[model samples]
Target: MPPSLPPRRKSNTGVIVTVTLVAVLAVVGALTTVLVVMDDKKSNSVADSGYNYESQAPTPTRTYDPGPSSEAITPTQPPSAASSTPRATTRTTTTSTPSGPRPVLKTKDNPLFLGENGTNVVTCNLPKWQSTPTAAQAFFTAALPCLEAAWQPVMQRANLPYQRPKLVFPSGKRWSSGCGDVTEGEAAAFYCPPDGAIYMPFEGLNVQANKNMIGSYLSVFAHEFGHHIQALSGAMKAAYQQAYEVGPDTAAGLEISRREELQAQCFSGMWFAAAWNGKGSITDTVVRDMLEDGYQRGDDNNPSAPRDHGKRQNYGAWQKQGYEKNRTYQCNTYLAPASSVS
Candidate 1:
């Protein structure tokens, strides 16, 4: 060999540079992993539940029709009525607590969810229940003004459109309505959104089961009124559109129906709370009976019943929650988990 110019001096530069590059790469990779994890958590917080904390009305891309949705009652029949009308009365002013309660703007945004949890003590002096069809109509008619008294102010405060729902007492077992023709046994009562009418057929009320307990009938009527509230607040339209888009009989559609029905139950409880202990026949006994009736009206109570009205426990649970809380925010079924509604 020509003899190396000199023994090659050991150099740490290559080793040091290689180690530095490896360390830099490791740090960069760790940072990237951390960022990916944070982004995943942020994205899934609301998406997993399919809801958001936006306080805006639901936006529907197209018109939808919620056919004559029915609230079935106990299996029994009563007499028939040819006609009925809400008794006319002077408007009553409602007083609420100052600094109105704000709605819990969490899951679903609705106008009725916007107003104060009103504390207006209603004075509903109802007629005694009678088995005859005419007497039944008279009793229901008398209660109409009372219901209007209770809800008008609430609607006004919520900034929702308010109008007295039209009333009818069909005489036969089959009758036609704005929504469609309805068989007597199909439902005890139903609300027709197109015409804003509540069709209460005497034959469908199943009054024979609770002839003396007028509160039972009142609860039924109030549940229908709850649908009216949904209609006025745009909640009904939004829910119906979703169901229509996903096939009303599908699992998702049924879940949506449960939410609407359960909310109605809560609304009925609210009415009972407001009308309880008032200047009327609504006594402790009557309210208790109403609550019991709610407990019995769950889907699980009836075999062959569709699961659109929630299970037994949840059914009464929501009603009791509303009756005790007496706050609309407490009645937000849309915010509840799927398990709760199911």
Candidate 2:
């Protein structure tokens, strides 16, 4: 219009300007989006239910303790010793003296610690296992009765009532649980407190662990089942309440988890050792196999992994403590030094 450039040239200049503006706006929008997302991530708390895994796997239905800090809490009354624990805490950390398989019934003052021997020689009649889910279920089924036989006497002496924990063998590539959803191989086996059952997904247990070796898997099962035992005793509840006070993901919080897990390991070892001593299938060779396999089952070796379970070395050591020592009192993980648990 001002008699400057040709019409075609002017039109081309306008198009270039339009494209430049659009590009500038796009860059600005992208930057703004990134900033917003970063801010949101920074603001999210651990209690947000955004995080998935927990130390209490089979994972506890994460009831975030939005309450007082661990140090601030006082111990409360526990459930009836024999009654089913209400969606209570599950796991261990601490050691009590193990009364040799036949010791005087302990007192309320001398509560029956995990490893204190109650009665002697109850053999678990377990079959050699196969890698299939059905076989695994059968193996656990057979083994549990033995555990009940082994542990009931201990509880009775303590005046604690014993209740059998329900068992579930999830049968699918993908499954949902009271704790959360599962992808193949995401969980090994867990004692979920919410449902009061032990979930050992045959597929999940077999994910890198299924060698048709009964002792190897049995070691883990006994540990989780030890959790069930802990639930039965007031010990499991006390441990959880302690953990809640400390904070589940924090260092102290993690120690509590490690202690709980390690104690369970000790309890399992005691069971196996007790079985080995009797007419049971747990041989020294089986114990050796389980110890070797346990190196792989440690829960918190990686940096990103939640520090719920102990190191691989500790896993072996704690389990060996129970098997070798075979004293229930020695199974107390809480009394051990921090380095021992860590």
Candidate 3:
């Protein structure tokens, strides 16, 4: 009562202050709404699935060709060649011979070597698969030489060194590799970097083709060799290492896997080009069949599939890009825009 002077008169200034506060809050709310909408739009624009088109392509006609028979069959007994011949203990590197398609063994005594802890090489004894085992080894052996001839010069031109990997045709329930033990069902063609070799059980190829025998078998070897080319190129290590460093969910991981797979496809295309150039037997029909077979094997959606190579459309487009252009640069799937190919 002593200090309560005249009640202070509320002025228009008070109302102005209240109005200004309300206006400021409204402006802040509006700005927040705009920001949230923009963020949503940006997120929606980045695609997670990328491009997939295997469903739209037409089915390809299947074909087969059994090559001429050879007498140099796989040995049924454990390899005696290495046992009888004195061998060098230290690892030896050898250059592929320049003239023809023949298996280039480090030492003539052992065209094939067992992994460090592996048992000696024994001839495949699986019933009904006897003759094919030798043929498969011979075919792969020949193919490796061809691949070396084709890729070495290309690699040298790119300022990279070429390291030839060994080819192992194991004919049993399991085979040991520098990487680890490869079981029967797990035995489609694969390149084990640790051992620097390509491995395949003859039966896996037979099963993949439903015993069709030729087209698919040749294509699988080519594809596996394609991976070997990648290993030699230093591209595979770079890609996989980058993916490992970055989490797989990140952009880098996806790009790395895409690049590795696509480059292998391109290498396979180069092989086709070489075949066309050398033998002159590679017809348009043959090319089409190869593409179709590759597409089927690479289909990613199939649950029981052995490899996550790619879908049919993806494989076909990449193969077409490599063959039609016939240039490694053209098959640069990692750098190319998604809209540029299927």
lDDT of 1 at 57: 19
What value does the lDDT take at residue 94 in candidate 1?
A: 45
**What's the CA error at residue 1 for candidate 2, in Å?**
93
Tens digits of lDDT, candidate 3, 1-342: 111111212223221100000000000000000000001111100001111111111111111111121111112233343354443233335454343222222211221221111111111121122236786677567556656665565554433456787877777755565655544433344556656666656644544333433434445555556666555554555455555578533655554444445445554555555454343334344444555444333223233322123333454345444443344444445554432221
Provide the lDDT at 86 for model 1: 21
lDDT of each residue in 1-342, candidate 1, tens digit only: 110111212223321100000000000000000000001111100000111112221110000111122222111121111221221223346444333333221225665554234424566888888877899899889988877776667766555567788888888766566666655434456666676776666765555555576766776677667767766666776777776679756999778876776676666666666676244676766666665554444444334545565654555556555555455655667766776666
Model 1 vs. true fold: TM: 0.67
In order, what lDDT does every prediction score? Answer: 0.50, 0.48, 0.38
Model 3 worst lDDT run, 10 consecutive residues: 21-30
lDDT of 2 by residue, 1-342 (tens): 110111111112221100000000000000000000001111101100011123232332110111211110101232233452222222345455332322222212124552234323555667777777787788889888877776777666555657798988888755555656654434445665556677666654542423555666677577767776666665665665666677867898777776666667666666765566555686656655655444433433233556465554565566656655444455666666776665
By TM-score, the candidates rank as 1, 2, 3
Report per-prediction Cα RMSD to one decimal: 27.3, 24.9, 29.2
Q: Residue 240 CA error for candidate 3 (Å)? A: 1.4
TM-score of 3: 0.56
TM-score of each: 0.67, 0.66, 0.56
